[model samples]
Target: MTPDEARTLLEQSLRVVVPDADLTGLGGETDIRERFELDSLDFVEIVERLSQGAGFRIEEDEDLRTIDAIVGLLSRGTPHPV
Candidate 1:
């Protein structure tokens, strides 16, 4: 999928975790976890949703660290686990 498509998916994933979050106002560099005050479990939820939604496995801490990274990853396709 394209970056835009991945971004859309990320927004969907974020909303799944935080229904009332202002995802549209977030920039590319936005840290979803910090911005949303998400705990580790919440982040895992986002990762799970993103992976499932995009049909890929994101099995790394770094992979889901920021909105941009998540979008970049989903856009470029899945990366093999390190």
Candidate 2:
């Protein structure tokens, strides 16, 4: 998937997790956990949703702190160890 597509999917997943989250003016590099006040479970749910939506398995150790990082991972199709 393209970055734009991945970003859209991420946004959708975020909405599913935090319906009232204010995503406006959210930067690519912004910390999602900080911005949305997501706890560990919420974060995990979002990651699972993203993985299911993107048709890929995101490992637990992946650097998914920022939207940019998640989008990059999704756009790459499949993840490999760095």
Residue 1 C-alpha lDDT in model 1: 88
Report the C-alpha lDDT of model 2 over 1-82, residue by residue, as the tens digit: 8889999999999999999988889898999999999999999999899888888788868999998999999998775322
Which residue pairs of candidate 2 clash? none
In candidate 1, which residue pairs clash?
none
lDDT of 1 by residue, 1-82 (tens): 8988999998888788899998667788888878999998888888888778888777856556678888888888866532
TM-score of each: 0.87, 0.92
TM-score of 1: 0.87
